[model samples]
Target: MTHSTRSSHPRRRTTPRHPVSPRGLRTLRATWERQAAEAGGPGGFHHLHGPHTHGWLLADAVPELLEPIVHADDDPLEPTFFAHLDAPVAEALLARFAPAHLVHRSNGSPTLGNQLRATVAHPGEITLHGFVLGPGRCDERLVSEGALVRFEADLLVTEHHAPGCECELLWAYAVDELGLDDAEHAPHRIHRIHRAEAPDETWWRLLWA
Candidate 1:
């Protein structure tokens, strides 16, 4: 008679029903950890720009995970200015997810609609997808899944808006102070801004304004 021994290891389970891709999750998690390690004082936010989407990601103590808040219906340019201005929907969105954990993304051209959309969707996941797969493919997936709808007019939207909106200020800073022609270059320019020893008062005003 021979005795047989059984292995004690258990098989790992997979979640096929997860809404976001594994790559996206990993990218987001890694980004969060990196930002957390690099951040000083309270953890702050980081910005991302994908071919089809752009938005902010925050690092904080408590992690809050939620579905990517899709804003496919709203006008990415005009409505965004008012959305942050005492709007109930915006308030509710913030209340659900702390600004640190929220992910926001929008559709439009890199210069106009998309930039403004990312700007307003703050305090902001399609952003994660964009980072993982690059902008073009991410946009295709979102569009096929009905998470985004295309608007030709988004390209025509202007950068300048109401004074309190901050869009104009951002545009001015990027163009004037940073001397960047394209909004797509903001991340690189931001690094330069960070490395500067004495970035002047205008830099502060445009950034925090």
Candidate 2:
């Protein structure tokens, strides 16, 4: 005969779990990585856009200079070498790859809002997620239950706050989709600008001078 024993211990409630999606995290990681950009140097912000926007220096202003340097005729700039973009395409192309990338689709549309909102709620810190590239395609290979959120409070909100934010966020994934991930290895900085001043500025104007 076997005897069964029951313990009189009190039952404890388990903590609620918030599942994170592996797909959304891929883009989150890229954005958080920009925080450590101090090591790469200053131009991080300027290089992104300014007098000197492209890698080939004069190429950004004058696309003609890049035609010769860009050896590949079909896909002249295949993600690796940074030449100059046609002044015409420069703005559009960069916007296509701005923000975090993975969160955007091929046409450069945002794929997530709740995740982005959660991220903005907390600043200065980031949460890493689990997701791997599939079939080497950046499109829909990501597998996530839900994206994790990281809070990083910078002097300013990320420069990715404009209309380009949506497009740029998408382009990176497209490049990854195009299998151009290994093209450029250089470090890039995400611009951070403060928003606190906005409220103060508004108050000052409404009150005195």
Candidate 3:
């Protein structure tokens, strides 16, 4: 999952933190090592942002690429849903959000770089992608989920959720990211139908077979 390099980890908190086992930590570290190797080998450590950025550092990128879709109120590709994005960016976002429904959230915020961030994930991928569309350079990275949790803990994050099949939300986030372009690239027809909900008690009475 790719997200913004900026710090905005406090945006969502519904998912609570669970203890990390010693074995889990070791496994996570191994995953991180592999990620670092993919990024030209871990040449020591570097500080990107925050205090913990000094270990096995990975670059970052804008978070909106995937976060806004799942977090959208309804249709992930709805123009209004991504109004915050520029014309070009919005168009790209729509292309990615195809095969979506209009079920939207009462509240949605586009504050990836400025004040918030979005976590983009995909199934079968060990690294999480992150980016920041705010000021400074465009930072992006593919980092290990285990290492990210360890780094997050160092930042004193009271709650943490490691990315894996065990966590439904994280799993969905990953799958959604991976499948963003699935609807557009499929071999068969992809249908998206819209239906209005019953307005009142008598609304259902008008239904007919």
Highest TM-score among the candidates is held by which one? Answer: 3
**C-alpha lDDT of residue 190 in model 2:** 32
Give one digit per residue, the lDDT tens place, for model 3 in 117-179: 122331112212122211111122211111011010111111233343223333233235333
Worst 10 residues of 1 by lDDT: 143-152
Q: Tens digits of per-residue lDDT for model 1 on 1-209?
A: 01121122111232123244355344433443343344322433223443332222231111122223322222112110111121222233233333222323322213322322333353221121121111112121111100111111212222353344433444444455333233333231111112143333122212111
Task: Report the Cα lDDT for residue 96, model 1.
Answer: 33
Q: What TM-score does model 1 achieve against the real structure?
A: 0.19
Provide the lDDT at 100 for model 3: 18
**TM agreement with the true structure for every prediction:** 0.19, 0.17, 0.20
The clash numbers for all candidates, in the given order, read 4, 25, 29
Error of 2 at 3 (Å): 70
Q: Across residues 122-206, which tens digit of lDDT does each residue of candidate 2 receive?
A: 3322111222221112121211122221212222323334543432333243233322232222112233223362432211000
- Top candidate, metric lDDT: 1
lDDT (C-alpha, whole model) for all candidates: 0.26, 0.25, 0.23
Q: How accurate locally is residue 165 in candidate 2, as Cα lDDT from 0 to 100?
A: 42
